[model samples]
Target: MQRQHSFDQTELGTLYLVPTPIGNLQDMTFRAVDTLKKVDLIAAEDTRNTQKLLNHFEVETKQISFHEHNTAQRIPQLVEKLLNGDSIAQVSDAGMPSISDPGKELVAACIEHDIPVVPLPGANAGLTALIASGLEPQPFYFYGFLGRKPSFQKQELTALANHQETLIFYESPHRIAKTLVNMIEIFGPQREAVLARELTKKHEEFLRGTLVELQEWATVDNVRGEFVMMVAGNDVEEVDESLVDLSPIEEVVHLIEAGESTNNAIKRVAKRRQINRQDLYKEFHEI
Candidate 1:
């Protein structure tokens, strides 16, 4: 229950989450540029990439590397600087800072320490693709990136199979074909979907069709660039109980096949069936 007045004067400096352009440089907002220039320090996901954006905008702010690899080490230092009244702006390689990006940890630290976090609205690939997807826009779910592992990804898709809202997913070019294949298996071939690529760039294109058509296109055409895949929601209700027929060990095996850890799968099965956890664990391990 914390309230933040972004512009209010305080001893601690405000952390500004600035969004950069996803593709075209023109999409970089004026406020984002200004905040980048005005902040005492810039925590960037990639300093070299950010330097290019800074050069384009004629902004000469000093930047420090603050990516996924360095988050554990950087968060404390950044928070300390904020406490010392040095305003900081956090930016990712593209789009919003914390949307499937690296700024959320820093944002959490700032909030925990009573520092202000000011966010600037700017380009986002998910929403950018959603509006033009020719699907239901209002009740859409944004699922940024799917798990790389086949089983984990299948599990995730299986979990979302019954969602009535439209679903959004980010996928790399190399894996689009495989992802679509998995989606077809879980969401069916007839589900309407749109694949947006090279968003806001000169070669941007949108392919709208059913899951099977998209898979065919992926197989036949040259699939390049990052993709934003918007899938139409499930219209027909599916039977929710997928694990009802399986024995306790078989249920655990199913979850394990879907990439869940064995111990966790056993615990989940035990809790759901109101069985003794120790007995399930012993039985699972054949002990």
Candidate 2:
């Protein structure tokens, strides 16, 4: 039997996942600029937005729109270009492509066709905020964007309230106020939280404190720009050692059988009972 290697840049089409500036144009990496200049074509989530970036860089790479609306139709043509020896770079409006932004479908398609996909890491609002947030970075979850409706947002927050890992989410200026209020209600007013706005821009600000304090500050007028919210996880409540030893596994299974998700069940039992979900998870898997 013979072994086959994956697509190479010289043999197959190269798909570059290029990250753009989150706010400040200067944040664009030197390598990213070089990649854009060298690629045969650029696929942008928003051509207009990307045009401004290209203009700033003076990199004459041609760009075409490849966002959620047109990704399905655009995949074939992009793959064809790659097959024809053209290297294409994918860029979202801001930050990295496919980081809860766009570009997953194209990347998946490229993988199926054995195309060479290379990612050039750069500015990421979520990670940038998380680092500045002073929150635990390792055990954190990224909830890209919350639902706009109050009800949906509330349900989502409530479901995640008891999460043991730090939570990160993105929000627009228009809805930041409402989102903060919902956070206070669901995650408790005292939960540690951080909100970073206008990252890398002149008005960039990192607001840190309890949910209540953040909400209070956000109420002021003109508090606006791209925002990344980092929230502290629920503290384990002390359990009465005398209580019946209801194994966390049993509780998880019970709740799941009653229609709760593994996630929901874990959070519910873990927060209310002060049990480590991971410990129970290990036991469950071992058995």
lDDT of each: 0.91, 0.86
Error of 2 at 285 (Å): 48
Task: Tell me the RMSD of model 2 versus the true structure.
Answer: 10.5
RMSD to true structure for each model, in Å: 13.2, 10.5
Task: Pick the lDDT winner.
Answer: 1
Q: Taking the tens digit of each residue's C-alpha lDDT, what string does model 1 give over 1-287?
A: 99888898789898999988999999988888898889999999999999999999999889999999999999999999999999999999999988989998899999999999999999999999999989999798989999999999999999998898999999999999999999989887767899999999999999998888899999999889999999998775332398778898998999899999988888777755646678999998999
Candidate 2 clashing pairs, residues 3+ apart or interchain: none
The 10 consecutive residues of candidate 2 with the worst lDDT sum are: 1-10
Residue 140 accuracy (lDDT) in model 1: 89
Local accuracy of candidate 2 as per-residue lDDT tens digits, 1-287 = 32234343266768999999999999999999999999999999999999999999999999988989887789999999998889999999999899888889998888887777888989999998888889888799988999999999999998998798999999988889999999988887767899999898898899898788889888986776878999998775656464347677776787798899877877777656544556666676674
Angstrom error at residue 174, model 1 = 0.2
Residue 250's lDDT within candidate 2 is 76
Instruction: Name the lDDT value of residue 130 in candidate 2.
Output: 89
Per-prediction TM-score = 0.82, 0.80
* TM-score, predicted candidate 2 vs. hidden true structure: 0.80
In model 1, pairs of residues that clash are none
